[model samples]
Target chain A: MEKPQFDLQQAISRSIQDLYEQGTITNSDRHELQAHLEDSAEGLITTGLSEEEAFLIAQKRLGRPELLNEEYAKVNHNLRTDKTWALLLAGFAAISTFIALISYSGSIYYYLLERFGLSNYTWPVVAFLCLQSTLFLFIALKKREVSNFLRDQVEMNPLRSIVFSFTLLALVKGMQIAVLRYLPKSFSYPASTIYGFQGDKLIEFATYVSLFCLFVSLLSIFFSLRSPTKGTWRAAFEKPSIAFLMLFGIGTACFAASTRSLSGLLPVPMHFTLFGLVYLMGAALISYYNENSKLHLFFFGIFGFCAELGVGVVADIDRAQRGIGQIYTPFFILSLIVGLMAGWYMGNMLRGKDAIPSR
Target chain B: MKEISKELMASSLAPIILLILRRQESYGYEIIQEIERLSGKKLAVAEGTLYPILKKMEAKEWIAATWKTGSTGKERRYYALTQKGHIELDSQYEQWNFLHDLINTLWKSPNLTYNRL
Candidate 1:
């Protein structure tokens, strides 16, 4: 007689959630509205109306969810702006945390592997890529759930997500350092000095850092499965990027500054890890953001991904081509024209709701 | 019964709500039902529009709400008029009466010409 039935309660709760997403109502407002509906339905039931009839009438009086959202949105003009800042912050935190873990962790792992007389990195790379693909698959399959969760975190508390991510990255980062004293070293990590890295050490450091960042990112997204976070390497692991030029600008800076600190890093070649990262990141962004996908975007994604992988391979051909545009330049800037159509298909497949709209 | 325009309902809701709260503390459902009964079911205020307005009036300190356990052991938010609300009701009453009288006068004498500044 007092509490509404579960079905009725759930319906009202959805309406309340819609209002919440609009940023207009608090939990107490939700309670007040729910109480009103329950009371109305209870009274109607007492008057010989069926339970469903009573629920419908109560819902009608409460107003439609769309209209309610609009009315609620009237008060919070900052709602969308706040959400954008939160998204960018979370994205930045995830990307940086991955970079840091990579800078240091691989060297630590390589030492452990060599001590055991195991020289293969093939298993780890395969395992890492598979885990990454699973994550991309999860985003596709759980698209509805993840998007809702994303909205809840981004809307409620953006900064908390950043703090939450840092904690996880820190945990993974901590694991590598704790093992450092026990492992045999083929290379020295500057840890503090930027000049500690050179030649083979730099290649090793950059390679592992790139590889580990990709691995951690996959792990991070996987953990993000249960989490609100994503995964990390570097002694320069100590510190930690943009839209278009901004991404390039930061990538160039990291390429130059971390050059020495990165000396002698990963067991797996750098190209493999970077290829995985580009595919996953591009896929994640495309699938998550694009609402109504045109099939052309799918083909475009494949083209773009291939070109991106091609560019990295082209650059690895230019380890001697180490500076800013130098990597992309020697690789033939044609790769850029070529990559525009690649990688985004996996994104479209992961779009979840409307994967491809057939005209 | 005549269907009241939402504009009139919106303007009149505050004074009516202030009066209802003055008589006794009541929750949203009861206050709305009371308004419907008083107006012979001619008015139907939306819960959507009503709550936000309640929030504004609550902010103005013309009303205060407290949670109480209703008969069925469920919590209900009951609202009461405050000192400022009595003043607001009086103000609204005067404003409405003046407008009411002016309209009555105009309707009674539709052809009168007046000076313009």
Candidate 2:
């Protein structure tokens, strides 16, 4: 008896069904595979084989369906476990946040009571901190499993990571501003008993701190964009744009200068001179880092040190007169904007051909 | 007598399957027998190979399958071509024809001269 011809379509249909049932291939993947199989079958038939023969031959060529299913299972497993890791990290972060809040409150309360006649409110502030810590710890421990499971689901979408990081920055900044507002005026500058320290100076200090924090946040954003597949040292090399470093350096200088001046009895003219020097030094550092020469790093170090010295001098000048003033000026604004733009440009340049969108 | 590579076979299976299903809805055993008869026993796909492909295609919505009672009262899965499968068949047929024409032109060139001549 002649051997009956095999139906290639029947084989392909069965394989797809098996894969889907096994959770090896997604619905869309099954469709794509079917389309590919159809083309392969046609090619076999055109090569002088009968339809039935072509179908059989095509099936053999497609390789072991079980092996493909195994590969799919491995990928799915990795996705599921990675989700667990993300959840674990989020839990740790929440606990850390609670701890940071309690520490912040304690420091603020102590400073307020010691500097002003605000000892009556210390217990209330301490109670509030304790309550916050208790609530955070309860939530962290009780919902650990649920949080991990939910994190697993959320981590599948990349955009969620960006939103989570932004939310963290917002929370940190909010807490910092709140702490600045509630602090006693005398704690700001004790030596300036001749002239009372206003809340405006505290606000100014908060603004400088916020700007510095914003610069660091941008660096974090860049790092998030360029994560390596694995390993700690390899990960650090995936730095953001050079512009980020420059902006951060200037922001740090401004913050340091303003804070020191607020505490110190600095002369107004000397403080202004120091501020001008900070700009000049920051500009030099930016120029040095931007250059593509062998001496670029050396120049960067020299200029960065100069910038630090300039900020230190300005703070000293402010301290000499027991005065506090604005650290941000038109030059600071221009440097920040220019640095951000340069960083973005450099980042895009580094991304190269792959960065171009398909459409 | 030489066997084809697995990659080539895998790539060609889809069109062959679609073409066969276009003829009529058929069960696995019958389809296997038909293929063997048509190929003159040149290609013999193991049961392990054929079933997975069938399941995969069915999952893709390119074909639909139903379990029906065979003449022996045994249950057998029958599969039929879907509308998407038909459209895919047309597109693949066009691509195959283009490739065939290009290969024929390249291989059967009349302007070639032999070294002996």
TM-score of each: 0.55, 0.30
Q: Against the hidden true structure, what lDDT does model 2 obtain?
A: 0.53
Q: What is the DockQ of each candidate?
A: 0.48, 0.05
Binned by DockQ into CAPRI classes (incorrect, acceptable, medium, high), candidate 2 is incorrect
Docking class of 1: acceptable
Give lDDT tens digits, candidate 2, residues A89-154: 554554456445544554464465456645345455445545554554344333323332344344
Best of the candidates, DockQ: 1
The 10-residue segment with the lowest total lDDT in model 2 chain B:
B43-52
- Output the worst ten-in-a-row residue range by lDDT, candidate 2 chain A: A225-234
lDDT of 1 by residue, A134-202 (tens): 565555444335655765676677788777877777786676566555544453244421322232343
The DockQ assigned to candidate 2 is 0.05
